[model samples]
Target chain A: MGTTGTDIRYLVIIGIAVMLLLFTSFLLALIFNQRKKLKYQQSMEKLREQQQNQLIEAAVRSEETERHRIAETLHDEVGAILSSAKLHLLGIKSDILDERDQQLHEKGRELLNEVIQKVRGISHNLHSNILKEFGLNEAIRHFIRKIAQGTVLHATTALDDNYKTENPDNDISIYRMVQELVNNILKYANATEFIVSSTHRGNELDMVIFHNGDGLTQEQFEELRYQKEGLGLKNIQNRIILLKGSIHFTSGSEGYRINIHIPVKSNQP
Target chain B: MKLINFIRDWSEVWALLIPLIIILVFKPAKKQLRPVILYVFAGFILNFLATFMVEYYYLMPSWTYTDGYVNNNILYNLHSFVRVLFLGWYIISVRQYKFPFLLKTLLIFYLVFVITNFTFYESPFILSTRLYAAESITLLVICLFYFFRSMQDESDINWLKHPSFLIAAGISLYEVITFFIFLFFYPLHQKDISFAAVTMRIYTITFVVFCILLALALYKSRKKSNLSGVTG
Candidate 1:
């Protein structure tokens, strides 16, 4: 071949090489670009999850704080006034009153005492001072006593004595969650018998509520918790999340059961 | 009659005016589109001037000086240089951030090649066949890159309606067909004048097709903007 033929042949080879180089570069860019996009999506999903957890924590804290404030007001202001009224009634002399007046004084003293007791009970229910002073075991016992007085649910609890949490806030949240679950069993489960069991295993506290009646299905539980009428269940869920706990709901032919596991130490910063 | 033949021979030069006029009349809404339209218009003016100079030299042979000053071939070389430069600019702008460093290095190399061709390998008075071949190959590569880049884009706009895709398609088609013609121009022209003339006609036809595609791109861009304006 002549010089011109040789040059043309070289140009053809050069053209093929250029095309191959571009094609390879394009493939590499595409692969890297997709990998980068996937990473970005994962980071975005993580950020969204973090934001949701923070919101739930804030809500649970605010609700607990409000409950404490109301309880304090009832105990301090209302309980004091009623106690004073009962003391004054007690100070009235029998000789200064006719039979009818004496009878009225006695009745008035009895009513004042009942009102004082009722107010104190309401305050205690709102914020359990027993849970704060004593701990989770005493609080559960007190709760069972309160529930046993009103209903025929035949409630029973067995909490490990050694089980303790360093954070009272976390304990209150866990207690509230258990309280809500028990209330749910009482109101909806229609069970003749209910059981509450708690144990400390390793760094985790496991609490289970088991009842012998038909309860909500998993789908129903999820759906209900999102509904407007399921505020109580939603509150329980938020408290569990605040305590860095996990809850499982299971239903069988026998009954429904709720098992919750909370870490002894809170994971919150 | 001779003037008619001259016009027929340079039909691609005249075809460039069509897109230039259309783009100016429709006026793309995007500010970024202005550079592309301005370059196309510059190309049209350049082609028209080159054709005119070549025709004038042919008609007035007596006016030509023996001292190698100004001629048709030099004007053709200048036209090719400007066309490659503008097309490169368009591709680089469209690719934007996605344009690879390797392509940039290749562009620098192409620039150097053009300078060397004009200065040493090929004189201004001679047809720079090698440079034309290199331009076609480089442009073909750029057009293919545009295609691959467009494929990777997640834009909702229909690919068929995309202005850049349409322009790339047109450029790719032209380059694919004309590359071999440019590669073998010197040898073929040395062998037979008829073969060269036939190849030139094919070049004119492909050039006309490319201009039509560009005009369509401008029209699509204008329509897209109008639709967005009405909906927005």
Candidate 2:
């Protein structure tokens, strides 16, 4: 009986040691797995952040580019026409002082009026008052109509009325984001048909942009994500997140899909 | 003969009904309408009727229950039915997901085993009781592997966030413990094992521990779905 008791105690000690060993091993394994997963996630996040930085930078550059474009238009086209009109006015004053000369002066005055009208058209192109007065939906509608009729590509929109953003600046962001995505489609995605869907759930907005094109392969995507570091994609995502949103990209048999979810509080009045 | 006929009469109904309940209630995607309606439902119906025949006509309990003839009542038979439905769903899900070659081969192997379970020369006493028990347990393991492999690639379907894999792990580990008990008492009839049996008994206590872990994993997984921005 004493021998049996001794054996039992020995067995109990061995059991404790064995249990501790197994537990430590299991815990270490779990920790290792979690660490590996965390590393993977961090790497993925860094890639996205870098990509977004590029897009934001590009958006900022595009705004500047638009400024330059307008400046160039004003200087080159309008400036040249005004110079020509000044030359005509000078020519009439020196060469002819008769009634026939006065008639030529009237023609120059009419040409000046036409040049003013041209400047007004340029101002409208730079900042369409239709956007402020009509709201985003209508502005987008007009934009699409203009683009569709003008361009070979077909663009369609699906808007969810329930989704609204609390931040007023989001209106511009929304416009720009849509503009960027559509721009990508116009530039990159080859297939003709494209879709832009926005769903408005309470305090959240889900936007899906899909296009059929010769898209990047998974490896190509990863490579471009690291190597090319697109700025347009980044700007859209950063702007979305500024509205408290997240974005993801996936490619499958359907081609490339971009799903962006924006967390919002209230609608535009 | 009277007793045999009585059990046999109700056997078909129990076999069909029990499996039908399991398939309709427990099997995932039962409520799903399109595409999966006919395929999944058809399999459930056939498996249900097949079980009915196996229960009443094939493996009816005619002998005395005094020694070791299903120590539990008819409700215990649901265990058998659950195992069948579980395996049936496993095959369908695996086929849908296109499981890895290893798991597919294992499934085909299991079917072969089930077919041969009949040809095994058995003691008449063990035939009715242990045969189905053995089959159910073996299929459970195979089914667990099938589901496990299928889940590795099943990312788009996040309804329950991989609940099937969690359940499979829980059920499989539970059966492993229970199978040892069976092996000790009936299969090998090991009268005593000084150290090995002691280890197994201690291992059985950890079943609850593992179960708690499984539950926690499932709960965490559900919370993960909420963390994501998936639209309904």
Best of the candidates, lDDT? 1
Q: Write the per-residue lDDT of candidate 1 for residues A101-139, one digit (tens) a residue.
A: 999888888888888888888899889689989998899
lDDT tens digits by residue: candidate 2, B1-232? 9997655544433433433353454443323212222323443444444445444443645543436343232322333434444544444453444435655565466556545653574433242334444644565555445444443432334322344444444444445444434433332223234544554455435444434433433343332222322221
**Could you give candidate 1's per-residue lDDT for residues B1-232 as a string of tens digits?**
9998977867857788777877778877666566568668777776776677655665545444336433566656766676666676677677644748766776788899988887877787776778778887777777766666655665533444567766766776677667777777777667655656776787788889988988888777774422110000
Chain B fold agreement for model 2, TM-score: 0.41
* Cα deviation of A204, candidate 2, in Å: 14
Interface RMSDs of the predictions, in order, are 13.6, 10.8
Chain A TM-score per model, please list them.
0.80, 0.52
Candidate 1 colliding pairs: none
User: Which pairs of residues clash in candidate 2, taking residues 3 or more apart in a chain or in different chains?
Assistant: A52-A234, A54-A231, A55-A231, A55-A232, A55-A235, A56-A235, A163-A200, B15-B52
Name the lDDT value of residue B184 in candidate 2.
36
lDDT of 1: 0.74
